[model samples]
Target chain A: MLFRLTREDWKVILYNLGRMLHLLSFVFLLPLVPALFYRELDTLSYFFFTSGFTLLLATLLSHLCRTDEQMELKHALCLVALAWLAASLLASLPLWLGGACSSPLDACFESLSGFTGTGLTLTVDPDHLARSLHFHRHLLQFLGDGVGIVAVSLAVLGRTEVSSLLAFRGEAREEGIRPSVVRTTRLIFGIALTFFVVGALMFTLAGIYEGADPGTAFFDGICHSFTGYATGGFSPHSQNLMYYHGLIYEVVAMVLAVVGALNFNLHYALLTGRRREVFRDTEVRVFFFTALLLGALTILLLLGKGIYTSTEALFRRGIFQLLSAQTTTGFSTVPPLHLSLVWPLSLLFLLSLAMLLGGCANSTSGGIKSLRVGILLKSLALELKRPFLPRSVVVGERFHHLKDSPLTPPVVRGAALVATSYLLLFAAGTLITMAYGYTAEQSMFETSSALSNVGLSCGLTHPSMPAGLKLTYMVLMWMGRLEVLTVLVLLIALALSFQRRKAE
Target chain B: MKRTLLCLLLCLSLLPCAGATPVSVEDLVRGPQEWDGRTVTVTGEVVGRLERGGHVWLNLLDNGWPLGIWCTKEQAEGIRVVGDYFHIGDRVEATGVFRARCPEHGGEPDLHAENLRVVLEGRRVPRPVNLLLLALSLLLLGAALSAALTLRFRRKEPFLGYSPESF
Candidate 1:
C-alpha cells in the first residue's frame, strides 16, 4: 500500500503538507504573545518548544521531499485529510506537555475540537487554566476555521489550480473573488478581519458594562470574537457564554454567530454593493426561514412546559439556544444538563434537525449545508409536482446561489448522496454511543452534535467518557469538518492502493 | 440538677451547628438525592457571577465541578472579582440548602445560601514579564524576519518559494 505511491506522488503530498505545517508553526508562535502578556512562563515554554519542533519537522520534510510536480486530485484529497490529522496531533503537543489534559488522547481530542471548530472540550477545571493556554484554544479556532490553514497555505504557496481544488476538497466552496487564489484568500481574511475588529469592540464594551474589569473584558472580547466570528464555540470560561450573563453580550454574540455562518460568497456580493443578493440567495432564504420556524417552535415548546414563564426568558434562553444550534455555534446561555433534562424529546429532536441542516456552504459552520438542504427540498418539491403535471409538460428546476444555476439531475443526486451520508454517519455515531450505555435521546443529541460540528453537549461528552467514544467523536468531528466526501475519498484511495500493492 | 440543665443547654447549642453537613462540591453534584433539600456547608473559591433582580448566581469551584451558589445581592457584595483567566476570586464558605433541580432557575443544580463568609480575599494575579522567554521569542522572531527578507530579496516568495502572481 505504501509503495503504491510513486516518489513524485509522495513528494506532492509531503511537500504541500510541509508547507502547511510551516505556516502552522508561525501560528504556534502567536500564542506566545498571549503567554508573554499573561506572564505565564511555564506555558510560554511549551509554546516555544512546540513551535520550534513544528518548524524543524516542516523544514526537514520540505527539504527532503522537494518536488516540482503539481498535486493530483487524489494526492490533494489525501493531503487535505492527512494535513488536518497531522495538524491536530501536532497542535496537541502544548496542551499535553503542559499538563492541561490528563492524557495525550485527551489533548488530541481538545486539539481536534479546536482545529475542527467543534467546541467540545475535555480540559480539567478550565476556570484555573492559564490565560495563555485559554487564548491558544480560541486562536486555534480562528486559524482553523476563520482563516482556513489549507486555504492560507495554498494562498501563500501561490498554487492557483491546485489551490482551487484543495479549497473545494477542504469543504470550502471556491468562488474566486479575484483572478488569483492568493487574492481570494486575502479577501476572505480581509472580511474576517473587519468582522473581528467590530465584534471585539462590541463584546468588550458589553463585558465592561456587565461589571468586568477593562483589561479582563478586553482579553475576553478578543478571544470570544475569534471563536464567535468563526462560529467556533470554545469559551475561555467553563460556564461558556453564560459566564458573561449580560443581555448585551448575548445579543452581540448572536449577531457575530449569524454573520459568521453566512456564506462567504454572499458576504462578497453584499460587501461589493450587491444588496439584493442577500434577499435573493436561496441559501440565505432557507437559513432565515428555518431559523425563524425552529425558534418559534422552541419557544412554544419551552412555554408549554412552563420551563420559562416570562416572555423575556422565552426569547433569551429558548430562542438563543435555537439560534446557537442552527448556526452550529454552541454557545449556551443555559446549562447543558438543564437543556438535556428539562427540554422535551421533541424539542431536542428539532434542535438535532437544525444541527443536521447547518449554516451556509463555504462558511465555518458545518453539517449538510443549507445549500444542499435547499437543493434537496427543492428537488423533492419538484418531484411531487412533476407527477401531477401534464404528460407533455417539461418541468425544470433552478436555484439562486451566486446566480440562477440550473438544478440538473447530477446536482440533485450529489446533494442527496451527501445528505444521506450525513444521516447515516449520525445514526452510526448514535448507535455507538448507545452501546456505551447512554440513553437514546442523549446518544442521538450528542451524535448529531458531533456529526454536524455543533458542539452543544447533553452531558455525554466529558473528560472521563469512554476512550472509544471519545475517539468516535473525534473521527466524527474530522469527517464532519471535511464534509465527509474528502475523508471518504482518502479512505477509498488508501484501500484501493493497498489492494493494488497486494496484487503486485 | 442545675449542672444537668447547663449541660443540656450546651448540647442544644451544638445541635444547630451539627445540623449543617459539610460536603464536597463533587459529592453534592453526584449524590443530589442524599443532599437535595438538605442544608449543607461547602468551601470553595467563588467564580463567575450572574446578577439577578435581588440576588446573584455564583459558581463555586473547589478542584472539582463548579457548583452554582445562589445568594442575595447584599451577600455577594463582598466579592471584588470573580475567579477567571486573569484574576483569582475570593475563597469562601457557604452554608446553604442544596437543590438538585432548582424550580425557580429552570431545573438548574444550585444552592440557596443562607450565609456566606469570605475565607480569603482574592487579588489580581501577578503577571511579571519573563525576561528569558521574552529575549528568546524576540530572537526567534528576528531570525524569522531575517529569513523572510532574505528570501524576498532573492526574488523568491518569503514563505513558499514562488512569486505571488506566478501561478
Candidate 2:
C-alpha cells in the first residue's frame, strides 16, 4: 500500500458517517405519513423497505466503527462531501422503487438534486407522482438546505463539543449564531420549522381560496412550503407556482424564498428583536439592490418586446422569475422553455448573472453568495481609489455582516477564490453543454442554473437528455452545494493521505 | 356566375373551422400571445382536476406540456379518472377562449372552456410487482432486525475490546 490511515482516523470518520446514516434512515420514513393518509399501499411499502435497508446499513457501520476520537477539519470536509453523496444514494431508493424516476441513474440524479437543494428534476412527470414520493422529494430539500444536513445531525446528537463545530463549519462558514454548535444547530432548525409552518399555512389557505380541494391544498401547501423555504423549488404540479394561478400564492412564495435565502444569523437577530440588522447588514443591502436592478431590467425587456402588456404581468412573471432566480429557487410562473425561446438573449444573460450571484451565505440558497459579491465589490471600489490617493494612505475596506468585520486580505481572497472557481466552472459547463448543439445563451443559462444550485431549466434538463450531460450537471450540483472549496479540499486531502510518507 | 358565388360562400364559411382545429397544450403555452382572448380548440388528457365554487380546473397534458382549462363544474364532473400513478386520465377535446393572462384569475395563463367533450374514457393502469425487489426488501429488513438483536445481546464488552460507546 502506498499509504495507510490510522485506525483512529477511520474510526472518527466512519463513526460520524454512521451517525448521519442513522438520521437518514429516520428521514426516509417521514413520507409514511402521506402514504398512510393517501392509502398508497405500494408507496407505504417502498418506504418501509428503503428505511429498513438504511437502518441495517447504519447499524452495521455503527457496530463496526465505534470511536471517541474527535474529528479534525480534514475529516469534517471529507465527511461533509461523502455525507451528501451517501445520503443521495440512500435517498434515491424510495423514489426509484416508487417508479417516480425511470432509471436508477435518473433517480439518483433526482435525489441529488433534492438533497443538494438544487431543485432540478429528472422525473418524467412530477405531477402524476405518488403523494408520498412527492412529499419525500420536497422533504429532502428542507433537510438538505433548510435545516442543513450537518446542522440537523449535530442538533439531533446534541453534543456540545468541537467535533460538532468542525462538521458545522464544513461548508467553509467561519461563524455560527451561538458558540455551542449544538445550541446553534437547534436554533437554526427552530427558525426553519417556524417559517415552514407559517409558509405552509399561507399557501394552504391561498390554495383553498383558489378552489382547490382541502386534501390537495394541504398537500401542496406543505410540499411547496418545504421547497420554498429551503430555496429548493420542487413543485407537485409541473406548472410549479403557476398551478394555483393565484397571485397571493406567488407573492407568499416569493417572500418565503427570499426569507430562506437570508443569513440565519440575520434571522436570529430579528427573532431576538435586533431589527436594525436587517437594514445595516451589507449582504442584505447588496441583495436588495441586486433584486431591484435585475427585476427592473428583466421587466423592461419583456415590456419592450411587447411580450406582456399589463402591469400585473410584471408582478406575476417578471418579478416572480427574478426572485426565483436571484434566490436560487427554481420556481417559475412561466414554462422553463420560454426562458430559452421567448425571452431575448439579454434577459437570459441577466438572469444568468443573478443565479451566479445567488443569495446570502450561511443560508439555504446556493451559488457564490451575495456576501462574497459584496466583499469583492467593496474591495474593487476601494482599490479604484488607491491609485489616486497618496502613497502614505493605506485604504482599509470594511463591511458589516452580522457585525463589523474588516475586509481583510484573507476574507477578500477567500471570497474571490470561491467566486472565481464558480465562474470558471460556469464557463466550462456552458462550453460542454453548447458542444451538445445548444446555443451559447441556452447553455449559459442552464449551466448557471445547475452550478448555482438553482433548479431553473432552459429546457435542456429532461429524461431524454444525453447521459453525459446529466452526469455533468450532477457533478456541478454536488460541487456547487458544497461551494466548490470543500470538495476541492476533500480532493486535496485524499491525494495527500494516499501518498507514501518519507522514512523518518 | 352561380358556381363562383357558391364557391366564395363555402370558402368564407370554412374560416371558423381553422380556429377550432385541435392544437396541442404546448402550442398554447409556448405562444399564448397569438391566441390570447381568441376562441381555440385543444386536445389532451386531463392530468388533474381542481374544483372551484362554480368552476373546475382541468389541467390538460399533451406532449408532456400542461395547461389548465377553466370550465363549469358540470364540464369537469364528467371525468371519472384523472391521470396519476395508477391510471391514465381521460382524453378530451375542449374548445374555449385561450387567455395568455386572465385578469380574473390573477394573470394566469388558462383556457376558459365553453364547450367540453370527452373523446376517450380513462382506465386504471396495472403495475405488476417486481418480485425480486420485494424479496430483497424483506431480506434486508430481516437482516437489520437480526443485527440489532444480535448486537444487543452479545455486547456486554466490546467484541475486540477496542470499542468506544453505544450509538
Candidate 3:
C-alpha cells in the first residue's frame, strides 16, 4: 500500500524531516553552554561534533529534497516517525561520546527515554556524570516530549495546512486555540517559558533556603524547572527528589507537576478569562477528583499499616508519591527499592492504576488520559441508562471541555480505541517482563509505568535487565508517546513499500 | 611479671575502642536480612540529608548500592555539604544497627547510627571556565539568532500553501 506514494510525497517528508533535524541541531548545541560553563571540555567537544554533523546532514537533505510540494497526512505521519527515530539516534551521539552510557545501545535507550519524557536511565551512577550531560538529559525531555519537537518547528516555520497535519501527527492537540497554528505554537511556548521561569525561581529560593549554595541551587533550580514543567522526572542527583529532602521543595515540585499535566487548552482558556471552564471541564474535574481520591487512599493505607509514625510523613511520602504517579511525573521522595521491597501490595496496585489513568489529555503526560477515561465512564453510564428508557426515546450525551460538546459515537469510539490500545500495549509489556522471570505484580506495575511514560521503577529497570525486556520497554515508551497510531502507520508503510520493491 | 600484666591489660583496653569492621553498601543492601539488628560499620559519601525530630537521615552511596544512615543531631553535626551537582559530599563512617525494615520510620531500610565520624572532608568541585568552547558556543548562538531573524522577517511568504491571512 505504501508503494502508492509518488516522488512528491517523499519530497515533502524529506523536506520537513530535514527542517526538524536542523531544529534539533540547534537544540544539540545548547548543551555546549552548560558544558563550557562547567568546564566539561570533553563533553563539550562531543556536542560540537554532533551538532555540526547534524546541521550538515540537514542542509544536504533540505537542498536535495527542495520542493514546493505540500505534505499529505501520510507524509506527515511518516515524517514524524522518521524524525523521532533520527532524533533519537542523533541525541545518542553525545551521550555515547561523553561516556555517560556503557554502549551505543544504552545511549540510544537514554535518548529515547529522554525524548519520550520517560525518565528511565541506563546510567548506573548519575551522580558522577558531567553536570552538562545531566542537564542535557533533562533538556531533551523538555524539548522533545514536553513542548514537542514538531510544535517547536511549527512555531518557527509558521502555520500551514501541512504544518497543521504535522502537528496533529506529532500528537499535539488539534484544538484551535488560536486562529493560526503558528500562533498556537507560540502560545504553547509562551506558557511553557513563563512557567519555566517562575518554577525555576521558586525552586531556587526553596533550594537555597534548604541549605544548598546559590550556584548549585540555581543550576538545580533551572534543570528541575524544565523537568517539572515538562513532567519529565529526571533529577541531576541520583536520589531524585529525595536528595532535596525539604517540604518546600516538594511543594514546589508538586505544584509544577500538576500544572505541567494540565491541558494547554485549559491553560489558554484560563489565561483568557474563561474561568468557569476550570470547574466545568470534564477532564479537569475527573483528574482533580481522581487524584484526590487516590491520594487519600494511599494515605489511609500507609496509616493503616502504621508504616509512617506521623501524619506529616504519611502526607509527604504517601500523598506525594500518589500525585507523582497520577501525574505521570516520576519524582519521588521515597526510594524505588523501598517501594518495591517494603510497600504494601495494595498501595502498589493503586499506584499502578494511577499510572495507567494518567493526567489530562492535550498535555505532556502519557497514559490513557483522564479525558478518555471520563468519556469512557460517561459512555458506560449512558449505556446503563439505555435499559430503563422507553422505546423511541432519544438519548444524547454531552460533556463540557472548552464548551458543551455532544459525546457522539465517533468521539466515544475514538476514546475507546485509544484506551484499549494502551491496555493492550501494557499487557504485552507485562507478559514480556514476566517471561523474564519477574513477579506478576512488579511486572504489571513496571509495564504500566513504561507504557504510561511514568518513570517510576519498582527495582525492575536496571542496566542488567534482560536486553529483550529493555527493547520491549523502549518500544512501549515510543508507542505510548505517539499514541500508537502514527507508529503503526509508519510500520505498515515500510512493510508495504519493501514488499512492492521485492515484487518489482 | 607485674609490668608484663600491665602491658597486656592496656592492649586489651585498646581493642574495644577500635572501630567496628567496615561493610560494603552492596552487602548491606543485598543481605539486609542477615545484617538486620546487627551493629556494623559502613563508610560512604553522604549524598542526601533529611532532618526531622532532632535526627538527620543521610543517604550514603559507596559506588555500589545506596544505603540510608539515620543519625542523631550530634552525630550529624560537622557535615557541611551534601553531594549534589556542584559539590562532593563528605565521606563518613557510620557504626549502626541495620534494619531491613525499620518499625519507627515507615518500614524503611536504614541504619540507626550510634556513632558517626567524617573520614574525608568534601569540598566544592572545581569548574574552571573554558574559553575555547565559549567562543565556539557564541558562534553557534550567533548563527541561531541570525536564522531566527531571517525566518521572522520572511513571514510574508505563504507557508506550505496556507496563507497566514486564511486564519
Q: Give each prediction's DockQ, rounded to 2 decimals.
A: 0.23, 0.34, 0.18
Q: Summarize candidate 3's per-residue lDDT along A84-172 as a digit string, tens digits.
A: 78888899988887778888888888888888888877876777778788888989888876788776675576336557546554663
> Highest lDDT among the candidates is held by which one?
2
Q: Model 1: per-residue lDDT, tens digit, A99-149? A: 678999999999989988888889887887887888888888887888777
List the lowest-lDDT window of 10 residues for candidate 1 chain A: A163-172
- TM-score winner between candidates 2 and 3: 2
lDDT of 1 at B157: 51
**Among all candidates shown, the one with the greatest DockQ:** 2
In model 2, which runs have C-alpha deviations exceeding 4 angstroms? A1-8, A158-160, A497-504, B1-18, B29-39, B51-54, B97-108, B124-139, B152-167
lDDT of 2 by residue, A29-104 (tens): 8998987787665676688798788878877887789776777776777788878888999899988988888999
lDDT of 1 at A106: 95
User: Candidate 1: which stretches are off by over 4 Å?
Assistant: A1-5, B1-42, B49-57, B68-74, B77-89, B96-112, B120-167
Q: Which CAPRI tier for candidate 2?
A: acceptable
Candidate 3 local lDDT, residue B43: 90
Q: What share of the true interface contacts does each candidate keep?
A: 0.15, 0.41, 0.07
Off by over 4 Å in 3: A1-3, A158-161, B1-23, B27-38, B48-58, B68-90, B97-112, B120-167
- Model 1: which docking level applies? incorrect
lDDT of 2 at A434: 89
By TM-score rank, best first, the candidates go: 2, 1, 3
Candidate 2, residue A38: how far the Cα is off, in Å: 0.8
